[model samples]
Target: MIESPDGERTEHCGFIQKRGTNNIAELTAAIESLRRIPEGAEVILCSDSQYTLKGLGEWLPGWIRKGWKTASGSPVLNQEHWKLLHQEYLTRKVRLEWVRGHNGHPENETADQLANRGLTLG
Candidate 1:
């Protein structure tokens, strides 16, 4: 995430996560981005995954109460990360923004790099 001056009291925060087919990894990155910010600060979350954006914001709570199962009774993938991210969201202040991927945004580029770095290390 990159924080730049946005007038006096607010800062412009930019976040990027690597492209992933797995919804969980991308959502995890989004949660991580939120966690990196200070509490009560306004944040702008930029992500390429609509699933991650909508799932966390819209689908999560129901999934949690449903024992991490999909509406059709299939076990949800990446339940642990989902739960962790849910907890993280409860503790931080943020806003979500969707950005087109691979458009050469700097923070997006950096986050892609960081995500790849984690992949390589594992």
Candidate 2:
């Protein structure tokens, strides 16, 4: 889902692959949002998934250092999506914000519903 400064909101839903995870969905959302938002502008990405936020913020440097491997010597799950999200992060001025889900936040609730709707589309 993307929201404009003028209070316009848009939601997009589709499968990233035959198989997907929540992290992939979150990363895809960030990447797609970056594509939608104008360049050189400040953006805040609100997400309920700590996996996505930590993967981009606290874990990226180490992942790059380890050649995309986790601390346990395992390859990072959703490495491709992480790389894409990282690239967008480099190209855009984005701040990842962790929001509590189902906490009465209007946009968050709407996004959750849209995500559920996407699942039913299949």
Candidate 3:
């Protein structure tokens, strides 16, 4: 879900047919949100996944520098998605905000609900 600058909310939840992890879904959400907005638009991208947050804010640069390897020299998981998300993120002015999931954050709660609804889509 994305809340526009004018308080308009847009939902972009859907189920994936293939097996995937929660991190994949989270990354997809962030990636799709950035894809929807125009390049260079200022965006306040909120999420409840710390993996998504830290991976984007902290780990991404080092991972890229190390050819997508982690600190311990293991290959980074979800390389393709990270690459796409990183590319999308770089093309925009995005400020990532991490909201605690299931902590009474209305937007996060709504996203969770939407995600649950998406399960039926499969």
Candidate 4:
């Protein structure tokens, strides 16, 4: 979803791939959300996937430092997405917020439904 500083908002969902993981969906959503908003815009992104959140927020620096390899000597699973997300994050004012899913948070629930509906399109 994209929201203007003035409070105008938009929501979007789409398939990242025919075979997908939760992390991919989460990252795809976030990347698309960032792309939709204006450059240098201040925006808050919310997601339930800890993999996506921590991967980009907490673990990104080490991954980049290690040339995108994991601590266990494996390559990061979604290097391209991570790089794109990190690039946007560095170039834009994006604040990522974590939200617990299926806990009856109205917006979260709605987003879940939207994501589920997107599966039918694949």
Q: Which candidate has the highest lDDT of all?
A: 3
Model 3 lDDT tens row, 3-79: 78889888878887789899999888888889999999998888899999899999999999999999999999999
Clashing pairs in 1: none
Distance from true position, residue 41, model 1, in Å?
3.2
Supply every candidate's count of residue pairs whose N, Cα or C atoms clash at under 3 angstroms. 0, 0, 0, 0
The Cα local distance difference test for each model comes to 0.68, 0.82, 0.90, 0.81
After superposing candidate 4 on the true structure, give the runs of residues whose Cα lies further than 4 Å from its correct spot: none
**Please, what is the TM-score per model?**
0.69, 0.89, 0.96, 0.90
Model 2, 2-102: lDDT tens digits are 87778788887655656777777778877887877777778888888898888877999999999999999999988888888888788777788899999
Q: What's the TM for model 4? A: 0.90
Order of the predicted models by TM-score, top scorer first: 3, 4, 2, 1
Off by over 4 Å in 3: none
lDDT of 1 by residue, 1-122 (tens): 55545633222222334444556568767666667677767766677788877777788878888989988989887777777777777776657777777789776776677666667643
